[model samples]
Target: MFQRLFITHPASVGETYFEHMRASLGTAGKLARASAACLVHAIVPGLCKTTGSTAIMALHSEIYPRRFDQPTL
Candidate 1:
């Protein structure tokens, strides 16, 4: 059960559990920052104008090559 819940996904992605945890945390942090910046920009039109899109693009570049779009890997 533990293996199915934790180990399997990380292994499928060629990462250990710890590595996957770190990567997920990093992505979450980046998204949080982008979200905050976008919220602020909504109130002040000139502030953080490109922050959200830039962060999304960065995340996509880092994660998109991992074969995530396939039906099976």
Candidate 2:
């Protein structure tokens, strides 16, 4: 069995959000990390720093890709 995950977001937010994620999560974090990453990351950017925290979720799929650079191994 295999799984794949799709991560996307609007490009309207400033790059700081992405940079924060790149710093906090690091590249490899994406693997063990959950789908919640998308929403969690987006929360700060979308909320304009008004809020401090958010809840996220993960979708389990048999064909979801674990990493962006490589397909499920």
Maximum-TM-score candidate: 1
Per-candidate TM-scores read: 0.88, 0.17
Candidate 1 TM-score to native: 0.88
Residue lDDT tens for model 1, 1-73: 8887888888888899999999999989999999999999999989999999999999999888875543332
- Where model 2 places Cα greater than 4 Å from the true spot, the runs are 1-34, 46-73
Report the C-alpha lDDT of model 2 over 1-73, residue by residue, as the tens digit. 1112213221222335456456336534533353354445576555323222222122223114432443322
As a whole number from 0 to 100, the lDDT of residue 55 in candidate 1 is 93
Error of 1 at 4 (Å): 1.1
lDDT of 1: 0.89
lDDT of each: 0.89, 0.36
- 42: Cα error in model 1, Å: 0.9
